[model samples]
Target: MYSQQVIDHFNNPRNQGRMENPDGVGKVGNPVCGDVMYIYIKVKDDVIQDISWETMGCAAAIATSSMISELAKGKTLDEAEKITRGDVADALQGLPSVKMHCSNLAADGLRKAIEDYRNRRGMA
Candidate 1:
C-alpha cells in the first residue's frame, strides 16, 4: 500500500525527465530488486538551481524520486549533501518496509550526483 501523496507523485511525478547541461548526474540501482534511479542537477554558484530524475521501479520509487528532486532544488551542494535517507522517507511521510530501499536509493542518487558535480568542478 501507498499514501495518497505517494500515489499522486507516482502518477504525476514532479521534476521528471532530464536536464540539459546538467552540472552533475548519478545513476544507481539495486540489482536484487531491479530498481534503478538516475538524478540530474544543474548548479550555479554552488546552489542547486534545478533537479530532475528518472526511475524504473514501483510507486515508492517514483514518489521518492520526485520528493528528492523537490528537496534538492534550491539547495547548496553542502546543504544537499547533508540530506539523508531518513529525510527522504520523512518527506514522503512513510513507506512500506520493502520499499524503504527506494528512499535510500533516492538519497544515494542525490548524493552521488552532488559528488559528481563537485569532482567535475574541483570542489571535492
Candidate 2:
C-alpha cells in the first residue's frame, strides 16, 4: 500500500520532465525492478535553480523522483546533496517496505546530478 502523499505524487507527479541545457544530469536504474530514473538540474550560484526528472518505474519510484525534485529545488548544492533516501521517503509520507529502494534511487540520482555539476565546474 502507498501513502496519500505517495498516491498524490504518483498520480500527479511534480517536475516530471527533462531540462534543456541542464547543468547536470543523473541517471540511475534498478536491475532488480527494471526501474530507471533520470534527474536534471540547473545550478546557479551554487544553488539548485531548477530540477526535473523522467522515470520509468513503479508508483514508488515515480513518487520518490517527484519528491526529490521538490526537496532539491532552490536548495544549495551541499544542502541538496545532503538529502537522503529517508528524506525522500519521509516527504512521501513513507513508501512500502519492498519499494523502499526506489527512494534510494531517487536520492542517489539527485546526488549524482550534483556531483556531475560540481565535476563539470571543476569543483570536484
Instruction: Identify the candidate with maximal lDDT.
Output: 2
lDDT of 2 by residue, 45-99 (tens): 9999999999988888889999999999899999999999998998888888988
lDDT of all predictions: 0.87, 0.90
Candidate 1: misplaced stretches above 4 Å? 30-32
Query: Which residue pairs collide in model 2, if any?
Result: none
**RMSD of model 1, in Å?**
1.4
Candidate 1 minimal-lDDT segment of 10 residues = 95-104
In candidate 2 the C-alpha lDDT for residue 48 amounts to: 98
Model 2 segments more than 4 A misplaced: 30-32
Task: Please give the TM-score that candidate 1 achieves against the real structure.
Answer: 0.93
User: Cα-based RMSD of the predictions, in order?
Assistant: 1.4, 1.3
